[model samples]
Target: MEFMQADREACDRLLPGLRERLLELPLSELESADSPALALFREYGGTQLLIPADRGGLGASALDAVRVVRVLGGLAPSMSVATAMHHFSIGMLYSIADLYGKDTEIEPILERVSGEKLLVASGFAEGRSNQGILSPNTVARPVPGGYVVDGAKKPCSLSRSMGLLTTSVAVPRADGTNEMGLLLLPADTPGISVHPFWSTFPLAGAESNEVRLTDIFVEPTKILRPPPGLTAQLSELEEAGTIWFQMIVTAVYTGMVSRLAALVLERGRGAATDRARLLMAVDSAAMLAEGIARRVMSGDTGNDCAAAALVTRFSVREVLTQALDLAVELLGGMSYIQSTDVAYLTAAVHAIAFHPPSRTSMTDALLDYYAGKPLVMA
Candidate 1:
């Protein structure tokens, strides 16, 4: 808890500098599909925000990380979305071992991350089609000395700058079933390549492209496996990573809505009621998500965390959509102008629901939770 507080403070302390940098970038370039906003963000040591203090990282708690991303989302939506991949990956990698009691050799990588300030990108599966981010899309074939992983993660963020990739793959078990295993390796390993895939202008800075791994060899030391009966226990680990991803990604969009609300305050009239309503709604959504994060950090990963995250994400997306509508309606005709930032922001806000654990999946999961059934989404 103390460490979490410290991380929160570190984020707060750096918010001003991040905001300033975003303001300095030109609106046109910032909206380009090939923006340098992320490059500039890294120059400010943003890569270290989620690293643990023991490993020379910021030791940011879930709350601290959320606050940082929320603020950045407003200033630079693409950068925030891009970095959320790294932060959530770090969150799971740093905490999962301790939670599950596996001495996964991750400290060396964490040390390298801290000392070298290397950026880590996520190749975790996301969205409704993926079902769950932990469900490995890649396959790991066992060999004499190690496993050969072959698959690809499309729309992988931080494509150009990441020095390492953190992902999971399915390994066949002797029991005629497949179990999930998390893997980490250097991004520059032979047979690993990044390709251009993202074309969305508002989010171009995220550099979300395709990362292909072709028969990449990984030793046992680089993989973390659950104890016996992984199928029964897989949900615990999956929820841990999912909660972290949903929380931070939701915060990223909240930051955008926040900026839109502030704009209403600056340049609108006769919309005080609407502005107040929007701000209140955004805050409520944020607080609800924060409550869920606190529980997950406090060691609660049962149906409660999974259910809350699904609902919070659903609610946040709805709130943000409404807020964006109010923003345009309040700002009047000027908002439609192509050159204006509001137009770009409005477009970016719609991409929130497109993230992961799609509405269909969450709806099913939420119903199961309410009906007192095992909280699993197929």
Candidate 2:
């Protein structure tokens, strides 16, 4: 309709006036590491957008969540990307909380997340070439009462501002094998520290750095182990995680490119046909993302849905890549030379391809899924 009009309205309703505040700040400030965007996001209740209303959250549906993320992506790219990780982590926890009763330990964490507006950072294995997102990046040694965790997550978004860190760890089993489990630990836990890692300037405000944990002790109650016999393929929780991650991330990049496309439309940078093609590319990608979110809301977040999410993500990546290149050209060389904003957005939009489960790595898995095989991440 009016270029993310409904999604912008959803943002205003969820976190009133957040867009205005982000707009007031310069793009350079929002893209810098010292940016106040994250703090502003926290103040605006952005952290509680995905939690269920019964648990003190607004309990927005999956469809609306992606819309909100798309709006944020247009205004503040780094904040949107960083918060996507938070939503992914919390989504996993709450999904488990729904499975288990309220008596579980996850209940308190959910309360703090909704009540305290605490941000949770995801520490899944990413940035490693040819590695699956489910692969544990941290090592957990069995100890009395719990386990000793030692490892690190590089390019971990929200590294500095996260109140809690949710990481995937390889838990030692009695038979000398390993099982994938999620570990929840407070950010202030001993041995947990953040180091400068992300050197990229586009999303420096995301606080994507190295989060190191050395000999960190975790209680048994804090670990959520997936059901057994999920070693071959995706677990239910993993599927949900994958679906949410793909949907949210795809929306973020779509918004980034949409911003550029908006500028082209506003300035009437090129011929009518060229402008129509640009809008088509951006709108198609947004619709693809919404499709995944719709599948999630319909209680269809299974292997097929996960495969569809990945397929949509990759498809959107290609569409947006072409759209971005066309937008930059349409905007003309003078616009790119006159301001840093256009260049910055161009650099940031290219990062979609760099996210986990790269196209090359997921090619075989996607082909197999298309051939009636289960979608496996390796």
Candidate 3:
């Protein structure tokens, strides 16, 4: 009946020894740019957690993945944020493979991901302000065999350590229009480079830098095009991607807040009622995320599920924000002045509001969906 004990045990079972190793390091080191958390994650087979067991991977359920992410967020916020991007991209790729079967050109690459433990970084428009989540910032020019991609993803997580870069691009058609497509390229491919971008100290270890692709040539097979005639609105793949992104990212932040809640209880910072409220806030958010994961596992990753995921994410955001404030207050000024852990985690938890489909941007869309219209992300 301990707080988050089941999830902690799940983390131990899924990625044995990672939590202990991460705990052995100081929080300052674990949150810094030079942190070894990502390396330790890869060494412990963290990359294979979502690749499906039959495909040479763990094939963890959506619920298990959320639990594992919650544990990681508590230990290393940066690693959880960076790996969320990786998992989102992996989920999209593997979903495509499942729909199309073994003939996918990306099948071997996926095999490498599960078999070799390669990390994939997502380059979606989520980082850009006032843009549709499905919009492509990176441009791709059609060539004889493939495309010469040109653009950059500022604040792309896992930029420094990713083995593969999967990005959304606007591909120009011969008929004088553009279509959204997903492109997969090796991280070391010619003309692909990473540069300094993320300047904030919090989550600095995530390597959220600018990844510039200057005329990087990719083969035709490497680009995943949406089925024809679906350009006017969100595609099924885009829906799934959104759901996965929102669910996993929410879980990561929830875990971060859970850490603060844990500290509050351990120190017995307040009266019985106060302690119960703090734990309830954090646990409620955790359960909301789990609800979305259950929906995904039930094969309902369409517009309704996507909307539910967004609702859960924003709801958790409100709940956790209050919980964070309460935990810090209960911890008192002495704890704040004596150590940086409370301050650091509080700042990190605020980052949940900055993630994609931000509340401000999604307000009108959500209203329309509530009025019985389809959920739209534009």
Candidate 4:
């Protein structure tokens, strides 16, 4: 099932350094209301992993990206998560340009990323918002030479340190219809401000906060205007974005499961059967993601991509849920209550289920896909 062994090996070379850096950071500090984890991540060149070689970066394949993320997740779930925003955004940007010959406007941003190791924060569709990922929560109105963007992206990840923000904005058209325009802007552009908003400690180190834009002028070249009809344009972006998002996010939590197993191994406690079951679940979920990665790398963007992404998210979410439950049951109450890191990791892993296209929404979409109909999520 693991088709990309060479990519995995290349990413494996990064593990020792990643684990060392993570071990140096205290769990207490990392789980605090304020932490320097993001700084440490940038210092580690975490943003450069997935950049293409021609662009002056690590040039990790899709499989390579997923493997590295899982390792990072095992060590620092928050960092793994926050960095996923950057990795997946870069992946999606490049894929659109290279595969679909669309969104060539993102080339400049990608160049800066490859050359300077710039971090990109994603404002993609998230949980419970009801606003489809393609349907922009932020709206921009056209002006003389540019557009004036007005709206806020709530809980924007990497709020404090991102160099660029890649998001979609709803642009009003003369025909009284809206076109989705992909917007790329420097994080420190005038009128853009980040405010603390996330109160949960699970991924607190990500500093996912509120980003508000008050009539900011977005230059013409920074916007990519897609064709009309949300479903048509969105389906294209969704197929590309969902595969990487599901793979990277799922890998991160799978790393936490790995770390828990490592803890038990080091302590010489727990039955072999218990640990095997947990690891087997983790491997099953990881393989599902890897299969999707292989399909993506091979440029298979048909319904398989959509179907696999939907299935991967659902399978990983269910497996991780069971794995965490088993970990708690086998590790016992005292260890569960006393081991704060384990407790936090378990809580953090659950956040993956809430990523996007809620299970309820995906069930109908998946059925439509197999039934030879367009996949749409409201």
Candidate 5:
């Protein structure tokens, strides 16, 4: 679901005037066969794009974040992914700083993040990690000063310009269960190396990677608070927050859907019947997405964040597929032209339809959640 166009006005006020100009520029990068989208993050001051104002940030909340991004994402399908990635980093850091790592030493970094001085991206994926748990196969062995992190993280968005690397590494804790620790590895650190090139079909604008950490020493201060206890509190915490991030992700895909819907209406405006129903579905899906975001942002503790994520994703999936079908059916032969937006529109649908947190796992989780069983297969 996407936000109403009018809602974007309030969301825009959170950022400086520079955002509009940035959005207006042509940023088709790889996805569009041009300059990479990573450039845009640098233009917007990276992670500082939407920090909350109260904490020396842009003062954006969940819904505001959703509205502003969905609008831009609808406009620039390829380039917007990088923008959204930077925002994700900002959101995660801010949330983490608030919950655990509160020492004043972090304030300066937080300030830099708020000011968008450095770009950051998540580095949690590992060769053997479970996509659902976000566990990393990387290992962090404690060293004299800090720890040596060694392993590869796959498909890290913005790996090139990312100054700060936030990752999860397998750290054996006192408890029998393997504990995952969050580590901050600077991009310039000696042993850290990123593959020179990266690309994804729909997110051509953003640069992702196979990130390698070869026994790199990270200072003790760099580690964010170790994830909360894995047993009880953390399990529940992960369950709650994971869906929220997923919801944020849904906005990117549906944002594009909203744009396609608008175009269909503009093209058909009283001209066709099939296109009208498709447009209605797209518009309705966008509204539903916005509603879910608003509920979460409003402090509704009862929000089924995961459920919303699952339902929203499935809805958007159907919305895009149907929209594409309608485009082809209504436009007839014109839609088949490779040069037309019809192709990109449908390609993007498939792109997000299969984005990480794969549909199968999402459905399984949703089923168990609704069935009220233990969330895992024994």
Candidate 6:
């Protein structure tokens, strides 16, 4: 945790310089030099924070990932992950080996990840599916030696310069229940293919793509945990995934919003009627963000982190939208320039809506909380 706090400070200091450099590059260019970034990445060990310390990772908390989301969201948005996002994933399954315990097949995988040799992408989204439904179209049908994973996952978050993905497939059980099992797929697998699928914000480091798994045979060892609902154990893991996801994702959007608010304040100077309003928005949102972060850090569980997260998310979207309006209103023609962050702000407003349990979904979730449905991941 101390290291994570230190990493946050380092990223804060490094971001402005990095953003300047990022701006200089063509937005269309997809590849980035891994060396310099990796140096800073190594300093913090990047997404390795999500992994466990025993496995050579920072073992940063769900909130720690949230903190990272804020930092990286501000610096890079969704265009490229500053470092690879680990599929902490089943690897987390390995880290807790004593309790839920280890799978020998995943130990070396986590070792390589902790060593920073391989990249992991998350494949979750599916086409034409209902929001918040875990049922996936990607089928992992049972076969003689292993399951044949044959399906295409749409809008999966991946790295352009890297390979490998961790995903879940819905299996039909003889017991008449659907099962979701996770898998780790290598980039070089014979039948696997990837294609980029841009989101609302072109620059959000999300870098999702369509992943097609064509009759690829995954060994039993590489298969992640058993299907969801198979036991109370799987349900617990799902909740944990929900909790971590909410925290980290909230971190990213709110971070971008925080920066956008700051930019608005810096540029809104002398703009007359709107300056005071913009200042209030930024300062208000900042206070809210800081307060909620403190609560999360103190390990406060009873508090409404979900509602606080929604408010933070809404605050970010509000501030960014206001900032863009203020930027166009204050800077006149210069706001239209391609080099301006105002342009980026314009894109980010749309980008925050990319993931599920989105603003609308989040609002519903928050409402459910108020209705006393118990702040469960639902």
Candidate achieving the largest lDDT: 3
Q: Which window of 10 residues has the lowest lDDT sum in candidate 4?
A: 1-10
Per-candidate count of clashing residue pairs (backbone under 3 Å)? 0, 0, 0, 0, 10, 10
Q: State the C-alpha lDDT per candidate.
A: 0.76, 0.88, 0.89, 0.74, 0.61, 0.53
Q: In model 2, where do residues sit more than 4 Å from their true spots?
A: 126-134, 226-234
- Could you give the candidate ranking by lDDT, starting with the highest? 3, 2, 1, 4, 5, 6
**Model 4 TM-score?**
0.88
lDDT of 3 by residue, 40-107 (tens): 99999899889888898888899999999999999999999999999998887887666656776778
**Model 6 TM-score relative to the real fold:** 0.74
lDDT (Cα, tens digit) per residue for candidate 1, span 252-307: 88888877777677666345787778768777767777887798779887767877
- In TM-score terms, candidate 2 sits at 0.94
Query: Which regions of candidate 5 fall more than 4 Å away from where they truly are?
Result: 1-4, 7-11, 15-36, 104-106, 126-134, 174-177, 196-201, 225-233, 269-272, 301-303, 328-332, 335-340, 374-378
Error (Å) of candidate 6 at residue 151 is 2.0
Give one digit per residue, the lDDT tens place, for model 5 in 1-378.
332555467445654544565556543433553444446545654345467767665566677767666766665666556555566556656655665656734566666655556677677541232553346557878778877878876666667777777776776566655556666656777887878455445555556666788988767666554544534544444544555555666677667766666665666633567666776776666676677777766665233655665577677777767765665556556545644455665666566755556667556766877887544311
TM-score of each: 0.88, 0.94, 0.95, 0.88, 0.83, 0.74
Provide the global lDDT of candidate 2 against the true structure. 0.88
TM-score of 3: 0.95
The residue-level lDDT of candidate 2 at 347 comes to 94
Weakest lDDT window of 10 consecutive positions for candidate 2:
226-235
The model with the greater TM-score, 3 or 6, is 3
Residue-level lDDT of model 2, residues 1-378, one tens digit each, is 787788898989889989999999999999899989999999999998898898888898988998899989988999999999999988877876666557867777777778889999988875576556667889989899888999998889999999999877999898999887778788999999999998768888999998999998888877777655645334677788888998999999999999999999999989999999999999999999999888888899888998999899999989999999999999999999999999999999989988777889888888888899999875
TM-score winner between 3 and 5, please give it. 3
Give the per-residue lDDT digits (tens) of candidate 6, residues 95-196.
Answer: 234333454455665666568645566665422434332345577778998778888766655544344666667766789776666666667788888776
